[model samples]
Target: KFCNETSDEVDRREHPNKHFICSFADCKATFSKLWKLEAHYSRHTGLKPFACGDCEKSFCTRYQLTRHHLSHSGEKPYLCSVSGCSDAFSTPGSLRNHAAHVHHQKENSYVCNHQGCGKEFRKKKQLKFHICEHTNELPFECDFEGCNDKFASSKALKRHWKMHKGYPCDEEYCNFKGKTWSEYQKHKKTAHRVTLPCDQCKKMFHNAWFLQKHKQSVHSGERRMFKCIREGCEKSYTTNFNLQNHILVFHEGKHDFACPFAGCGKAFAMEESLKRHFVVHKPQKTKLQVNLCDGCSMCFLIHYILEMLL
Candidate 1:
């Protein structure tokens, strides 16, 4: 018997593999068991019943609190078994990530096959997400009504759902909001004007991760070229994002962005093209009433008005 439906017991009997849905607002997450649903609901409620005795940190789950205790105790139970390399981590997940990046460089690395883009990822799932950037393929579609949002990964889609129901900043007179708990923490850091500067170019970024990404993309000698696949089109772009825009405009004819001004409903595939089109609707500046001085060949607005006044 389910709380949300009168005939849920009958429905469950017919569909034995039916999942329990999370009751959190705008969250479409489903779990196999009722206990899993209850555990997931804590994320939206921001409830942390498990508190650490050593510090003021709290976690929604007991397992998470147990993991945090390892950091304070300086205990590294998870160790790398690779020959001649000794590294340990508090969590098994950390150990796995390190093993993938460090130990499995040649055999287990997932390399991208796209021309000019040879980015390697630790996991095949990460490689799949990176391929979407090159192909402009968005497979994860949001089920929210009136929203046609799509993402390359399920994680991105989950983060986007939080924007509809995630908690806002508790600071007074501030309307800052985030789509995830990590994003909220990032906002707090940025609100205080905390910045990370690049060592090579000295460009300031909002966070360390962004700064690292900037360094890898700009400073690193890695360049990618995406070309149009359409017949008779010899166009190539520096990025896949730009190549996607070219395809939408020239081949697919996906003119989604429309001019907001009334009576001139011209649409464009790219937002930049629509922005450039806005200049066509701009009001012409009024020309200044000026008279050319016969003596010095100088133009003066006051000279024309002063002659009429005289």
Candidate 2:
């Protein structure tokens, strides 16, 4: 006899003993438990009884409040295992999805079936998107007045809208621009708020940060180790300046820095390295190894830069 026009026909079930339902206007959501009904009704009243311990934000559901706390703690539970890829995620499914798409290592790739096109993609979502490209369909467009900027995806359109809201630095002779609100705030804080004078170069900077970069890159005793970007190459260097020189001279077939010794046709990446080899054929200097904390190398690097400033 349950033959109502709008009721769920086949998959509907009635709760006999527990009969809790939302009393909110125009909301027909029903729940078997009182707590479930309370949670559903809270959305209509804009009532957020669950408050986060670390932040002022509140949520209607306890689960949402729990999830919001993770952001304040800076916890990324999922991590990528591929070499040279440090991308992290908040969930395991996201980590797996990124690995499959970015690394091209996923099994059973989804292939497109559009006539004579046999290109394969890692995900079903990607295959659907590739099909749309052949159809010449750009569904996402800017909402700005009289603008006709169309994009293939929603994310592209979102980043496009930020073009209208870029914050530019107004300091005399400084022509830096920030693309996002967070970036604008940081630029203002670091570039104009606090004046930090470099101890080595004696150059005045807005924030205390540029001082450490000036010291490490320009005057620090510790040298960085740069590795070859060519796949399967096992070569490394004391500095990127020398490493880039190596790529250009040896790999790219350039002979800019030749050995000055007569009858010695050997070439090198940097002129200084060539001079050192001309003196005596010695092994390259070892890189300065430091024990860094796992999963937070950047945090340590920023701390090191700040220490150098002092």
Best by lDDT: 1
Query: Candidate 1 lDDT, tens digit per residue, 102-125?
Result: 876344689999999999887999
Query: In model 2, what are the clashing residue pairs, if there are any?
Result: 245-269
Candidate 1: C-alpha lDDT: 0.69
TM-score of 1: 0.34
Taken over the whole model, the C-alpha lDDT of each candidate is 0.69, 0.64
* Candidate 2, RMSD to the unseen true structure: 19.1
- The backbone clash count of each candidate, in order, is 0, 1
Per-prediction TM-score: 0.34, 0.31
Residue 84 deviation, candidate 1, in Å?
3.7
> Relative to the unseen true structure, what is the C-alpha lDDT of residue 191 in candidate 2, on a scale of 0 to 100?
78
